[model samples]
Target chain A: MTVTSPEKAKIELRDVRKSFGAVNIIHGLDLSIEGGEFVVFVGPSGCGKSTLLRMIAGLEDVTSGDIFIAGRDVTELDPAKRGIAMVFQSYALYPHMSVRENLAFGLEMAKTPAEEIERQVQGAAQILKIGPLLERRPGQLSGGQRQRVAIGRAIVRKPLAFLFDEPLSNLDAELRVSMRIEIARLHRELGNTMIYVTHDQTEAMTLADRIVVLRDGRIEQVGTPREVYEDPSNLFVAGFIGSPRMNIVDAIYAGDGRIKIADTVMALGQNFAGVAAGDGIKLGIRPEHLNVAQSSSTALRAKVDFAEYLGSTRYLYCYLPSGETITVEQRDGRDLSSGEEIFLRCDPERLRLFSTGGDRLRSANTAGMPTA
Target chain B: MARTRNSSARRLFANIRYHGFGIVVGLLFLAPLVWSVLVSFKPSVEARQPPLPPWPVDGFSVQSYDNLAQYGSGIWTYTGNSLMVSAATVVASVIVSLFAGYGFSRFRFPFKNALFVLIISTVMIPFQSILTPLFLILTKLGLQNTLTGIVLVYVTLQLPFSIFMMRNAFDAVPKEIEDAARVDGASVLRVLYRIMLPLVLPGVVTVAIFAFLASWNEFLAALILLTDQNKYTLPVLMAAVRSGQFGTIDWGAVQSGVTLMMAPCLALFLLLQRYYIRGLTAGAVK
Candidate 1:
């Protein structure tokens, strides 16, 4: 198989918008995917991730704006001519055809020579490790085997880019993990641009070179997995990326880089020049960042509502004095009983501040100064 | 041990009861065909007598079959005509309905739903009511008194139902399969011929059987449209044989003709029974 050079696989969407009669699906959106990048579009259902992928694949028409693939304007091209292959969520293999025929169908349609088609089919079969099952129809294969055949079909095309629409969504948990790894390895070996759309955050975090987080037909954040998880751009990104999700608690910003949570006031190490004293702000912290602290004037007091044990770590579901609940990741394996009073504290640098309107508030200075 | 013995006896009785009911029902349906076949084998003198102990009481003879063979333009000519008309109808109906069903199930165009409803609604119109107009139209087109004309009429009559069955079959296939084909570089026609036609084979078989049976057994249209004695189909020829010479019905010849006509229909339904059942219930459940 010929590798697609990174330069020849770039895909760009220019002010694309999709509407269905009276309702709009994808608002005007522009995005450039570098060649050979494994980009995952992660969002909840109805977020237009699949719609965007379909438009790029030419399966769905672009309501407005243009799609350029490999420096060619392919907005009016047929799906086959777009030089992209897609693996559907359902692994749509032709039931009547053998696995070999399903993989060779595209080349046959293109009128390639029989020997050449055979060689390519064999190569794809070898790559997907499905040679033994070539003569069998799709009905005889397991779900994972069928998915491999679907991908193998795409591979024989040697497309410039591959688009996968929740391809692993139908597999069992163990198979999903293995297939995810196989897909990641496929991208690396082929060096083709890939756009994967999935609702599973684990898939997005583990497989994406860059993740595009979407919500309500709009992009919420586009960043590396680590970047999105560690430094979310807004409250939505912060809440959507993590498993236990970031703990968000309402706070009142005090003068001179200090914020008050319930009855406890702590010094915020970073300076917030735009914040005013007594202004309502939101404090965001990951579950792992919150630690059980000794009772002190600075530590926030809370009652442990529930402790969930997961063999290695426990999650402390705590209720603050203000009646807001937050989760803490306790890694020391110490168990805390429900209804016990506790105090929680975190390093100021591990904190994130969000405006009440859901935008992230960047710190104004790096100087560490206690503002008690 | 006593309980086990009792349960075994109950099982045996249940089996006997179940199979006994099945055998009675099966024999009830088979009785008419079996009786006609047995009577057709009887001597003309005995077959013409009142129906009793349906089989030939005396030695069996092929005299009735011999008489049937000598009817009209010969039984072979009529059988050939019926086969030709039925074959033509099946081919035309299958080809037209296959494409029509694919279009109805997959494509989008202006008034698509309305067009489909219009095609399907034709099934509600009775064939007898339109026979006069159809005859006039065939006469104008120079197709009257022709086997092609009979086939054309049968195909038209078969279309509404054949297309319905075919559409249901095509509709039951997942749209994703077609999408996968199109993305795999198959053209519209290729997708229908290679991918789709194979998947909907049972539906096509069902449609073909219906077309063949409809054209084969039809008497009114064939009688009204065909003028030549050489072109008379089995059903028309059988009608003529029933109203025998000088108003004297030949019971032996009628029995032989009935037995002959019943063969092909029964054989076809029995041969394609699996596909027939599946095609009827294609989209009814899912």
Candidate 2:
């Protein structure tokens, strides 16, 4: 962990903006990543997460604004002088270089002493468990091995921060999981600030101390995994952060703390003060939050459409009487068959309300709880 | 067991058909070189036969090669000139094209595509058509009868296609590799020379081979530009010997000269054929 110093490094982007020709890619954005924090930029493709990472690494120029790494302005500096290292999605190990040469190349370029370079290269190789593959060329290694060498190459640089651009994307599912774990372990052991970019929310959730959710080049929400998951700032974050996505359906706010879906009325329980009676609202619910009820009068009526069985848990796909589709996760082995009628129940506290424009609408009781 | 046997039999038949066609086409291409080698061993009178047979009926001898050595300034002079011109062309063209192609592939400037298209369009203008102007320019540069003139012209002619091929070769390298190298503390030139160039070496070999062959075997430019027989390349010298001014053509000398010309080309392909095919196919896919 004392590769450089255990001291953590911070990166700050001040009103950063990027543009290509007449098209703007990253809007004016401000963010501060604390020292040693594992911050993940998660978004769908074309959301400029990779662009932002490249800008921070100085591989891409900022259309406007400044970037500071460890309190030094690096916006106009070359990538080499910025003291950053990146692991590319392609694994970009020089095909002509052996694994040892690949790891030693940056140090050699910097005129590091031969013995010291050898020590650092061997140290990285051992850490990544690639000692046996040191002499082999990149083409001789598997996808996983190549990625390990790439990480080793980055590690030998002993940079202040590490930038990962979808590093696990080219790996197969099993290898991706293991490599993800390896990256998390590397972050913990190195205790260096790392900014990882990925479209996979699972990677973002498991790896990041804090996640930055982006939509159309703008920051949607930045918070801890639980904060983003349990309390999303907007509809986009709620739908994007979870597997299979959250079910969003239309509802009408009925008077006296009640919401109506079809002919069924549900109690708000907590007062959502700003909502007026008869105003249209969008309801968001996680599949695990919806329970299958036998015969409750307050339950929403639905007919089973299909079910996906996964040994321990099953997802039931259903259609409401009002023609909306709902997904419910069941673990109790409820023998719900296709085309059969069923009732679904949701806890009042688990319900999420959004105005028609997709902003999270907070109830008065939860207003002062926490904001993401 | 019967089905397995049947599929194996079908696969064997398919293999025969594929390789059978390939062998036939390969032999067709090899026939001329084989014939030239055979004729080079034949005595002068037998080599002049209307249809030169595969084997010399009059018995083999090294007489034609000896004849080539005895005539005019001799075959070694022409061989030396050809080697100098080809080597210079290969080195110059490959160096210019590697940097130019990398620039075209990685950097963006005003009218970049237009410039690339402009360079590529030079390939469409046949070398034969530009002979007169090239000769005039050589004379104006006072390089009219010099090996440097021939080398300069050869490098110019080889560049358009070489640059195009090298551009594709560089493009085949993922941009991420360059970015990774940049962040790894390599300067741009270091990235090109130490990283990118080595990876695209197959393409460089391909360009070198093409340039060497173009300059080595070139006839028209050398013929027009160099009026001095001593400075003539192998092909031009062979042409001069083939059309005997007052005497009958020295069939043995011409055959040996040709066999000599074919030697380097054959050896080059034998050595670098793998890279030749790889260079052509590398950038065709991802």
Candidate 3:
């Protein structure tokens, strides 16, 4: 087989839809992944991330649509003939075969020359650092070692692309992190288009060249990690992307570029033409964005309910008078006891507004909005 | 110190009692077999006497075996017939049940569960009740009085249990293994032969042993279906020896035949007992 050019390695999904009986698993979705790009699909369970990956791998059938790999329509092709390899969550190693046989299985099936199969197997073993484990069976190896054998099996195939289905989920935490770095390094060294599925947002943030956030079988946002984190397109993406999660407070829109939260009314430093005066809206702010205010009249008053100390920083879980809870990241080393009264402030420019229906309410000055 | 010593003594007594009961049960099962073996070694004339001093008091001899060898078209012919029929039955049953079990465990089609239940339901219908029908079917197929007929009937009889064991064995293997193989470019038949057969070997051994023993020891079918004297299995020959020639019972020949028939079954069970137990309990817990 000839090596695929970078241009020919692009994957395109056109209007893909999957349904089982009367229930729909994936709604119509269209995506194009560029050659040599590392894309991560992040979603909650049942959001069809893994299902979509399987469909692309040809392990699952497409109810309707076309899937293109290396510019060829392969929606109905066998998984092996589609020029892609997948590393499964369970490792899916043949328990009876040695690590060497496991790596050589696909090449043997393809009827490659005996010497070439040996060389490729050795190369994959060297790449995964599993050369010492070539004679051991999958049952005799640890979780991480089995995972390397699984990846080595995929690598020997020299596929046009690689699909990973939550491959690190079964390992211990420390091993997961190390394997994650190894996978990233592998992508860099090989420069192949790779699509990864995971529910770990930290992994998505750290590994993805581009992150596709999905919810309920629909794409919520597609962007770089920083873009999705700092400028989410909607409320779901905003709430789902961050670690300690962005805090949301119920607020009423007051006219003249202002919003009323709990009892304090503050200028938002932006004009919103999508909302009327006295209309209900949600105020979004990240934990790190909210700070302990130093005697400001415009600050919101809250009582600290708890503080979680993480050595370098603390998270203050506070409750407003209206019974709304919020978390504030404190890094100044000042300690505040539970039930202590405190004032919180956020930069006006950092505030985000959302309609009650969960869509972002863009400010008037942003593109595609009418100025007030 | 006194309490510890008393407890230690009590534990020792309990241990002896437990093992003593086990030994009693073991001997109860082995005693008849041991007696038959010893009686087969007695001289032809002394074997007819009372059971006192069960061993050959006149001196151990091959006279009973020689006597058994001379009865009814000779012993080797019947032994060969039994061996061929039993071996054919084992091979046929293993192949048929393995494919059937893989299908039932892995594939989905209309009436799959219902069909499996139907196959398994045949086990409840006693073999005696169906023997006449089977005989008639074999006659229609021109198989009566042939070793092939006996083998066919035995394989059919072994199907329900063999397939059940094999399906359980296949079900115990994870489906992801097959998926992985297919993704690795293995064809379906290759997957079954190269991967699945090794994993389900214990179940195959279990099926083969049951089929061999059942066909080897079966007497009624051989008697009812076969009309030729040369086609008699060992059990049928044993029955003839028990009836005796002209009102005189050949106790020596009968004891020798019994001993010979018991050897293969015991050896097979002992040799593959681990697989048999594992296959029996394969899906019982999971």
DockQ of each: 0.75, 0.84, 0.61
Model 3, chain A: how large is the TM-score? 0.96
Q: Model 2 off-target regions past 4 Å?
A: A1-6, A365-370, B1-23, B49-54
Number of clashes found in candidate 1: 0
lDDT of 3 by residue, A1-372 (tens): 344584239888999999988999989989999888899999889999999999999988999989998888989999888888899899989888999999999999999999999999999999999999999999999999999999999899998899999999999999999999999999999998999999998889989999999988888888999888887778998899998999989999998889999889888877885889999998889999998977566898999999999998999999988999999999888999999999999998888888998888888778464221
Kindly report the docking quality category of candidate 1: medium
lDDT of 1 by residue, A26-127 (tens): 999889999989999998889999999999988888999999888888999999998999999999999999999999999998898999999999999999
Q: If scored against the real structure, what TM-score would every candidate get?
A: 0.92, 0.95, 0.91
**Considering summed lDDT, which 10 consecutive residues are worst modelled in model 3 chain A?**
A363-372
Residues B1-286, model 1: lDDT tens digits: 9999999999999999999999999999999999999999999889879999898999788999999999977999999999999999999999999999999999878899898899889988988999999999999999999999999999999999988888889999988899899899988999999999988989999999999888989999999999999999999999899889997888889999999998999999999999888888787785
Would you list the C-alpha lDDT of every candidate in the order shown? 0.91, 0.91, 0.91
Q: Give native contacts recovered, as a fraction, per prediction.
A: 0.79, 0.88, 0.48
Tens digit of per-residue lDDT, candidate 2, span A86-153: 99999999999999999999999999999999999999988999999999999999999999999999
Give candidate 3 misplaced runs (Cα > 4 Å).
A1-3, A6-8, A294-297, A367-372, B1-25, B52-54, B283-286
Docking class of 2: high
Q: Residue A263 of candidate 1: its Cα lDDT?
A: 89
Poorest lDDT segment (10 consecutive residues) of candidate 2 chain A: A1-10
**TM-score between model 3 and native:** 0.91
Most accurate candidate by TM-score: 2
